[model samples]
Target chain A: MARVVVDVMLKPEILDPQGQAVQRALPRLGFEGIADVRQGKRFELEVEGPVDDAALARIHEMAETFLANTVIEDFEVKVETSEGPK
Target chain B: MTARPSPTATLNGGPTGRWNVRIGVVTFPGTLDDRDTQRAVRIAGAEAVPLWHRDKDLKQVDAVVLPGGFSYGDYLRAGAISRFSPLMETIIDQAKAGMPVLGICNGFQVLTESHLLPGAMLRNNHLHFICRDQKLRVESTSTAWTADYTAGQEISIPLKNIDGRYVADERTLDLLEAEGRVAFRYLDGNPNGSLRDIAGITNEAGNVVGLMPHPEHAVEPLVGTGRTDGLGFFTSILKKLVNA
Candidate 1:
């Protein structure tokens, strides 16, 4: 089986409230030197067959259309091969 | 397809018999304001038809309204998922064909997702869910929704949202400004740090409008804030559809 992972994050220009909330809480929790923080989301897709270059392209299209809103956010996809002998 | 109300039919708050003009209010799974939208439509003296996110048909509504709410639990960005719903597909097609459409708050987010309008919504710069009566100036009266308000007329309506900041590229913003497509602009103060105090916008065709405020909440004068400023939106569209 192949696993495709998609990561979505707000554009650098857009404000991220949840990440800011975390950054604010961390200071109270005694963490320091955090210049800034931005939150993001990740999705894992398990494909039934091997993920080839075409599969990666399809996953990218899916991410663009559904998994992430390109208007305010950007997305990246990575494919992983199973760790097994053929 | 001009939708006309029956002759000699009086529109009352009760039965509203003999009226044929129907306005559709869409309900997504997590939508929180469908009932308020329906009430506002009925109060505006039209039939309010409930449209489901999963359905493909608009039930032959003369106009469609996407009301405020946290649709799809605000997952993957607000309105991202709901925009792909079956009903929204129909709405997008119809809106492009000049069917009148209004999107309020999260519905505005959905409209942006569907590409019916430009720009995008982001979290409030203050990172808070702001709910308050807001003042806005009607900037364009040429659209189907704002005909009742004269240009520069100021009105107060409820503004509520966590993700209410509207952003777009400079070119798109300039085009919107140049074309006079800006329907409403925030007054008194910019509530959510939106670009140029833009509160709402209409499409190039002037048939679709999306904004970050809840006009449905302002229809009843007794609804706490005592503002009936939003009734103009409903009435304006009713007149437009009837005249079409």
Candidate 2:
């Protein structure tokens, strides 16, 4: 089994209106303890295949090309043997 | 008897010489819909040319399209940084010369940022990233990019963005209304707190148009919403080119 992790974020310089809205609303909801809030999506996929470096690279490419907009977001992937000690 | 090829086929290079309508799709650093926009242009029987933000020339394309996507990651504001791209300078000149230009979502933001269109995009009133099938009424059929649509014709398109709300000074809004420059109006409900449910607008010359919807994504019948309402935008330009 192989694992892929994907993260999506608005570009740093971009104004995140959604994040700002949540930050302003937090205090009103009695969550005054929160200082900052940035919203993003995270996805993890488990694939069944021969876990290899080539396969890991393909997964990363797919994420960058379609899953995540590299201009505003970046992602990292990890692959490991699903079972047993080496 | 030999069968004659359809005019469209001949124009698009079937038996006759190449008649592809060359369209340039501008890609800003954070643009998200450049590829999809190119595909849609191809489907509309036009040749799609990929244009870079740094390029000063428009590559001799007949028309230009600014695809939706966060340019410069929507830095400072949506389409703010992208408005300064070298390509926009050429587009501004070409648009003044009556070249048809269409802007979608983030592209719309860029048009506004460049002052190619009036009004500004602000944070949505609900203040959330909205992705939905939105209904819009075509208010003007005079724009080069909207000629195929009928006035008051309601169509559905995909709208997605955090700062998609449209805002303008009251006088500007009034002038737009008086001059019939308002190209589209939101129907059903306003997804964003746009003043007067305005969804899109066109320039005074009717050559430049901008809208906060993903018309490219709506062209394919089997896609997300399975609605072809947005296809009219592409067809309109094609018709305009053929007539010209």
Model 2 chain B is weakest, by summed lDDT over 10 consecutive residues, at: B1-10
Q: Which runs in model 1 stand beyond 4 Å of their true positions?
A: A84-86, B1-19
TM-score of each: 0.91, 0.72
lDDT of 2 by residue, B11-58 (tens): 555333555677889998989999999998888877788999999877
Compared with the true structure, what per-residue lDDT tens digits does model 2 show for residues A22-75? Answer: 899988888878877777767777877765778777788877655554444556
DockQ of 1: 0.57
Model 2 stretches with alpha carbons more than 4 Å out:
A1-86, B1-18
Q: Model 1: per-residue lDDT, tens digit, B79-169?
A: 9889999999888888877788999999999999888999998888888889999999999999999998998999999998989999997
Worst 10 residues of 1 chain B by lDDT: B1-10
* Top of the candidates by lDDT: 1
Q: Chain A TM-score per model, please list them.
A: 0.89, 0.76
Reference-based TM-score, model 1: 0.91
